[model samples]
Target: MAKTQYYTATSIDGYIADANNSLDWLFEVDEGTANPFGEFFAGVGAFAMGATTYEWVLENDNLLEEPQNWHDMYGEVPCWVFTHRDLPPVPDANVFMISGDVRRVHEAMLVAAQGKNVWLAGGGDLVAQFAQQGLLDEIILGIAPAVLGEGTPLLRHKLHVDELILTGVREVGQFAYLTYAVGDVARMGRHLAAETATLLPVNF
Candidate 1:
């Protein structure tokens, strides 16, 4: 089964980017000799991201000056950018600009994925929408050794132990990689409801 995964690197304090929305801290760390990025990309048939993340790639990678970089990174894989404002598309790059419910776009993404996994490459807000709607299946977080007092959060919603099961943990260089399988929201909601029923409220 193709899973919807959120693969991202974050600070020790759970921020994916700094206050300036920069990933300088992430770039400063050693990613190791392992081809995790390549391997993961191979399994990703499609990807989606928000406007900020899309623009970051456009500026940070200088995609305009070096259009080949976009091809080198994503190749022919289709990228969906969810944004309200108009954004320029990279020449020769397979990208679609869209807005509205993520659920509809998610369905389209799955079709494009062609049995491979769908990667949610995003700013936290976008990922939050997916997870909140019970669309996200897995989370692979590469936790860096450094901390950013405050910045963009890794997750904007509450995920209890029952909702997220730890599946794997590995330490690579200075980063601690954690993999978690998100539970079915319907099942988790029912379980939580049962637990709530068992609790007695005290009259204050």
Candidate 2:
């Protein structure tokens, strides 16, 4: 089975990008620490992102024209971009454009994933949508030291997360990378119920 994961940085206030949909605040960190993120990306089999994130990369020409060292690390993994409007394809065949209902896009992603990890390269709203639908398996957050007064939050609206176990924490200079394994709600509920039963007072 393929695992769906969300990997993003957030402000101390839990915002992913600024009000203008800019991630300038996150860039303030010393770029040296970004190697770990590249390593994390290398482990993934494929990539998936919302239309806005795809456009942002294209407009700015941020993504490298050719596969970088990180891309080599991951081999020729596929990347699917979910968009509402039509857009030209990337130079590399590895990158594909997808437009349709989000669920259908997800199904296509899973097929493209093919037992490998699927990265949900988010721009906030899209991530929130998948998170709300309970499609997310893990959330890998690179918590920056800086704070943003206002921006797009990583999570919006109410979500019932049964539990999030901290798998690992790494301190990269001033920033910290946190890995969390978000468990299934039903399994967590059962464990919580058992614990509650043990803690409750027994009247015989």
TM-score of each prediction: 0.89, 0.77
Please list the C-alpha lDDT of all candidates, in the order they appear.
Answer: 0.90, 0.72
- The candidate maximizing lDDT is 1
Model 1 lDDT on a 0 to 1 scale:
0.90
Top candidate by TM-score: 1
Worst 10 residues of 2 by lDDT: 66-75
The sequence of per-residue lDDT tens digits that candidate 2 reaches over residues 95-173 is 7777656677777778777777778888777776776677777788888877788877886645454556566798776
Candidates' RMSD to native:
6.4, 4.2
List, in order, the clash count of every candidate structure: 0, 0
Candidate 1 lands at a TM-score of 0.89
CA lDDT, candidate 1, residue 5: 94
